[model samples]
Every structure is written in C-alpha cells, then in structure tokens.
Target: MPKSLQGLTVLVTRPAHQASRFQQLLAAEGAHAVLFPVVEICPPDDLAALTAQLVDIATYDTALFISANAVDYGLKALATPQILHHLTLGAIGKKTAQALQQHGFTAQWVPTAGFTSEDWLALPQTQQLAGRRILIFRGAGGRELLADTLRQRGATVTQVDVYQRVCPKIAVSQLKQHHEQQQLDIIAVTSSEGILNLVAMLDNPAWIKTLSLLVGSPRMRETARQAGFDGTLIMADNPSDEAMLQALIQWAQE
Candidate 1:
C-alpha cells in the first residue's frame, strides 16, 4: 500500500494503556506516533457501589459495556462468574466487543458502524428494550445519552460507573518540548475528556493552533473549538483506528 501518512507526526491523546495499539496502527500507515496520554483509567472512588452493582448484575436483562475501559474495569470488579454469564451482553462498538470477547464473554449485540450511544440505540435489539432492565457500565461523569434515551423508550436503565477517568498530570512538560520543536502535525482526540486534557497540557497557544484535530465525532469538534483550539477539524468515518488511518491518508492526499 502507498504510505500517504508518511512523514506526518501525529499526537495520540487516549489513555496510555490504550494508546499503543492505535500508535502501531498509525505507524503502519507511515505516520510518526507521539505518545501523549491525556486520560488515565482508574478504579472508581466508591468500590462498594461498583461491588453492589456486580453482585446484582444478573438482575438486569441486558448488560451494556459503554467502552473497552468499561469492559476492563467492570468485569474486573465482578465478585462472581455465574451472574455475569447469565445476563445478556452488549458492547458499544467493535473494540468494546473484542475486549468483552477477550474476557470470555461474547457480546450478543454490537453496532456494526457509527460507534456511539445513538448508534447502539438504533439497532433492532435496543429498539425492543421497552419494559426491559438494562445495566450500563462506564466511566464516571460521561454523557447520559444512553441511559436517558433507554428510559424514554420505556426500558428501566441502571447505570453503574465502574471506573473513573482523570487527566494524567505528567504529560505537560513533554508536550511543551514537542511544541518548541513544532513536531505535532495531526492530533487524534477521541473523547471530550481527552480533548480537555490535551488543551490543558499544551502550554503554548501557537502549538494548539498549528496542529490539525482528528476528532472521533462532530461533538468532539465542538469541544475542541470551545477550548480555543482554532485548528482544522477532521472527522473520521468512525472512531476506529482504521477509520482514523483512512482519514489521515485522505488528509495527506488532499
């Protein structure tokens, strides 16, 4: 394949653990990957609350994993194997589904494209969730679109935030060094939290304006704009690494 992303230095702002695979994907497209993890995934402050939810996991008719982090943190919180196996499993996207599958649970329902809560709600399985009990596992303080929409559709939605996402503190200095070098070309901002953290981490205003933003959704583009980042907003076909890579290739061709 032609290397369209050749010589481009892209900054990846996902959680550090999750950044490697995406960095590798970018490398395959001939882009230089800059490691700048904005969000750090950690256990929620209230362990007992998560524990209580896991103990009662089987009571919900459907278990929805909001993200791959949710699958990692939520499944790890489970005190028993039986209850988890009995409940119907669903994942938000292909990555989340793969994460669940790796943990020995197959997601019976997964959205084929458009990896968002609205996309999941559009599926036939989710459309029939009326009168059903749905359990959502995600990080603390994210969007309530999924649970709220499910309730409006007549499903009883129970949310259990199993993990917490906070900005990692150490990347600021490294980002300053990169800014001085004018090394960052393309920036991949996956979520609102990541965008916020990235904006906070970069000290130089010129650096923020110089780099083009590769956002997962239009929502993220708005978040980037609000943070005073007056850069080009490039939306991928989907939030997947493959889609972002294709976007990068297209951007290079343009």
Candidate 2:
C-alpha cells in the first residue's frame, strides 16, 4: 500500500477516547495526527436513572442506539444481558451496531446508507409503528428527530441518555502552533457539534478556515461552512475511521 499521506499533518478533533484508532490510521499513512479533542464523552450525571431505565428493558419492544458510546454505556448500565433479549435491537450507524455485537448483541435494524436519524427513520420497518414501545439509548442533548418521528408514528418512545457529550476546555494554541509552522494540512471533525465546538474554542479561527476541513457528512460540512470555514471541505463516506482514511487517501491521490 502507498503512504498517500506522507509528510502531512492532520488535526484530529474527535473525543479523546475515540481518537486513537483514527490517529493510528493516519500514522500508518505516514501522516502526523495532532490530537485536539473538541468533545469529551463522560458518564451521565445520574447513574441510577440509567440503571432504572434498563431495569424496564423488557417493557420496550424495540431498542435503538444512537452511537457507539450509547451502546457501551447503555449496556454497561444494564449489566444483565438477558434482560435485553425481549427487545429488538437497532443501531443508527454501523459503528453502533458493531459495538452492540461486541457486547454479544446484534442490531436487527440498521440504516441502509447514511448514519443519521433521517436514514433510520426512512426505513419501512420503522414506519407503521402503532403501539410498538421503543427505547432510545443515546447521549445527552442530541437531535430529537428520532424520538419525535417515532412518537408521531404512534410508538411509545422513551429516550434514556447513558452518556454526556460535553465540550472540553480547549487551548487553541496547540493548533495555532502547528498552523504557525504551516504543519496543519487538514482538520478532521466527526460531528456537527464538534465542528461548532472547534470554531468556538478558537479566538480568531480564520487561520483554520484556510486549511482543508474534513467532515463525515453533508450536514457536518454545511455546519462547517455556516461556521465560516472557507477552505476545501472533504466529506468522508461515513464517520467510520476507515471511511475517513479512504477519503483522505483519495483526496491526496487526486
């Protein structure tokens, strides 16, 4: 395989816990990855509430996970895997499904293409939901589209937050230092909120607008553009590490 990213420096703005795999991918391509975590994934404020929600897992006919963190924290809170056997598992993204598989669970439904709530909502199985009780496992303060749509379809939707997505205290000087040295080539942002957080963390952020901005989806790309990013915007096929790596390699080759 070709080291397509040789001598390049990419800024990785994923959460600290999830940055390792992407960093390793960049390193394998001979690119330097500068870790600048914009979002911090932390346990929810109330563990008892999370545990209580899972205690009634059998009541819900369907269970949907929003992200990998949701799958991890949600299952961890459950502790008893047998309780989940009654619920039909669903994951918003492939990564979330993989996370469930790691926990000895399988997602019966995953979106066909995209990794957003819209994609999952579009499924035929999700429609005609009259009296199906659904439980959503996700982080705090995410989009309400999934729950709203399900409820609109007459499904009893309950959202149980298992994790918290907090904006970490960021020192943009680390990024600025790389920019000053002209070492920052591209900045990778996974979520729409992450790009917003990165921009908010910087004082001027004009320098970063000049660099290539890599995003996972069109929604995220639009978010970056709305945040005043004027440089080249690269959209990965999906938010997965492999997708982002392939996107970077293809961009470099072109």
Candidate 3:
C-alpha cells in the first residue's frame, strides 16, 4: 500500500563499508536489501612504482583520481604531507573529490555533471594537457580514455595503480548456492567489471536469466547489454549512495 518500495528485494554490490548506508536507505523505503560485494579492495602488492612516481609529484601539473577508492588507497600510500601539497588535484566526480577533501587534499577540478572520463575530458582544465605532466591514481584495470586523450594532447601521463579490485574467490560457491535457492531478487552492479565477474561466476544461462540487474551508470548499462543481459537494466545517475538508493526504490516500486 506504500508508495515506497514495499515487497521488492534489492541487492547491493558495493564494498562492505559503502554498502551499509545504501542498504539502510533501501530498508527505509521498505525493500529488502541484500549485499553481494563483487569486488574486494586491497592494497597493491608493488608500491615501488608508485613510490618512484611520487618522488616527482611536484613536477606534475595535475593529478587525477578515477574513483573514491583511489582517493582512499592512494592517499594512504603517501607517507608525508609535502607530497600531498605539490600538485593540483582533479576528480572524476563529487564523491571522489569529497573523499580527497576529507583526506586534506582539495581538488581544483571536477567533472561538471556526469561522472565519467568523457565528462572529465570536456573540462577546460583538460583541454591543454600539452606540456603538462599528469598523474592518475586509480584501481587496477579501468578505462584508458582519459590517459590516452591526455597523451594525445602531449601530456606526460603517469598512472599509479594504488589499489586492486578482485572478485572474492570464496563468493563463487556462496553465490551459486544462493542462486539455486532463488534467494537473490535484484543484483546491483556499480561497475562493468562487477557485472562481468557476476556473469563469470554464474556461467549457467538459465540462472543468470532469472536475476534482475541494477547498474550505477550508463557505462555499466552498456556493459550489461553487451554481456547478453536482455532484461531490464536500471541505471543510477551517479555512484553516490543516494543515487543508488533512489534508483533501487524506483525499481522496487515498478
């Protein structure tokens, strides 16, 4: 009888700490929230490369962070205050920028509206990457559009993979068992990688067919469509918890 999500079950695929707030918001809307973390955040094994890059941090004209995780893990690797003050920081979105600000770094540039590489590239600051040295801190394996475009503009780009995101190997069995039992109703995927990992774990077409997917962005929606997900693919305008919760509530209501 409620306008909010009542009987629907929604899955949250964000990291453990990040998932809780979204879960609470969904619960407030009366949807059953389930967490199925597709990726676990871990520090990179080799900091030597990152350490060397930081030595010349002051030389770089700009620094970029692709995700909030990058701000979290990348800031932790810097052992001193001096390195933090050297370059102008840029973030892909408000959330990532906020994380940087929380860690005492102020971002001079952020995407105007959309939280994607294409949006960031359109910023006036990104126009003249020529002759500028740029450092990008992010998780392992992501879009290279920004880096490639910067290089095309004659910027010397250095990428530091500060954190690694890997699907939990142990979750495979647990997810399979849950799927068999039909315990999962809606599965949320924030990244394209998370969707791929979910598909990889559940190779059975029939099982994957039964699950509804909620993606965080249009980029991820494209990924799901490409991966043969013909069912409804809901999109969150951004990756923030509020955006995700709102999308989940709307999906549940439908």
Candidate 4:
C-alpha cells in the first residue's frame, strides 16, 4: 500500500532553472518536493573573452561539451554559425547530445557508458589526440582533469568559459525551520559544489547526523564528508533524475 517515496520529503538543491523537471519526477512518485535552489546559473562577466574563443572556432579539430548547460549556453556565444559545421563535436552524455541536437549540431563522439570525464577519456578516439586542437565549452571553475588529461595526450585543449555558478543567499531561518520541524527528510545533492554550498547554508548542524543524504556519485559523497557531513550518503547510479529517484526508492525500501 506504500508508494515508492510515499510520506518522504525530499529537498532538492539543484539550480532554480534546472530543478523543475527533477521535482516533477519526484512528485509523480508521491514524494513531497522541497525546492531550495542553492546555485544560480548565469552568464560569465567576460562576454568578450567568450566571443574571442568562438571567433576562430572552425580551426579546432574537436569541440567538447561538458554538460547540457554548456551546449545550450556555449553555442550561442559563437561569433558565427557555420563554424560548428567544420569541427568534430564531442558530448559528455546523452542529454548534452540532445541539447546539441536542439541547436542543430551533432556530436561525433559520446561516452557510451559512465558519464564522467574518466569515462570519456577511455574512448579509443580520445586516446589518439596527438596534434589535435580541442575546444571545451563549459561553465567557469570546472575541473581541469579533462583538459589536463587531453593536453597530456598531446592535444591542444582550449577551454571557453560560457556560464558561471553563483551561490544564492538562502535565508537560514527557512532551512532551520524545516530541520527543526523534521519536514526535511532527504537532501539530494547533484554536484560537489552543491554539496559544499548546502553545508555552508545549513551550517553543519547536528540534524545532519540523523538526516538521509543522496549524492549523485561517490565523488560527491567524499566531498560531503570533507564538508563535515559524515552521515550516510545514498548514491545514484548516475546523475539523471531517473537514477536519483531509483536510488531514493531503493533507500526508502531499505
């Protein structure tokens, strides 16, 4: 007689623009969605620099997109449209490739399994990067692991900053009220940055000691631990909404 997430209250900390779909999916399964957006996705301050990178985009041998956000926001910064037709494209996963399709572009390469840079790097096409020039479109403050690995493989990797993440100023009273009243059941964190932001917002309370946490990956779990949350973290198979919901259901059943 129980729903998958019946009577459970889930707190999702994804960016405001990106939270609606995930909330809808959780709500469909009978979980009460608590929307507390901690991050604001915005345009980078330096538009000129973004345009400068795209000015010579056609010369690059490959262009890599880190996320769907990157594909949507990054391509519009280009100086011209025809340049995309000339370069080989790479997407981190299916959603990003879908975003590219919306933009009338296609990725020649995508990581088949596992949607991380480590997984993408495992592809045979990525191994032969010698003398290749790659343009990476992504948000600011992204990890250097991908670019670094590509450079070490004898590729010229250029990164264009498309968007920036700004942590919003959420009132502590709201979070404390939910925590005090026990309305906040599980907090789903999508990224390492989101994990740290949630820590700063909640101020590392004793409530976290009893709280159930959901992380998109093991990397996020380690980051949450470093942020003073040593509580148990339920990890999703991947970062998609479906995967996170599946993890949530699995945890609830246990």
lDDT of 2 by residue, 1-254 (tens): 65889988999999999999999999999999999999999999989877877787788899999999998888888868766767799999788888989888889889867788898998889988998999999999988999999999999999999999988986777678888988889999999999888877885457877899898998998988888999999999988899999999999889
Q: What lDDT score goes with residue 127 in model 4?
A: 92
lDDT of each: 0.83, 0.88, 0.80, 0.86
Off by over 4 Å in 4: none
Task: Please give, for residues 1-254, the per-residue lDDT of candidate 3 as tens digits.
Answer: 58487766776778776788888887887777767777788888887877776776777778899988998888878766457677888999888888888888898899868888888889988887768888999888877888999999889998989899887664567666766777777887788888887777566466675577888887788888888887767788877778877887777666
Worst 10 residues of 1 by lDDT: 201-210
Worst 10 residues of 2 by lDDT: 199-208
Question: Which candidate tops lDDT?
Answer: 2
Query: What is the TM-score (0 to 1) of candidate 2?
Result: 0.95
Mind giving the per-residue lDDT tens digits that candidate 4 earns over 1-254? Answer: 76788888998889988899999989888999989987778989988878877888877979999999998788778767658878899998888888999889989889878888898899899997899999999999999999999999999989998999888887778777888897988999899998777766777666764677898888988887777775668999887888999999999889
Model 4: lDDT equals: 0.86
Backbone clashes for every candidate come to 0, 0, 0, 0
Q: Would you give me the overall lDDT of model 2? A: 0.88
Angstrom error of the Cα, residue 91, model 3: value is 0.5
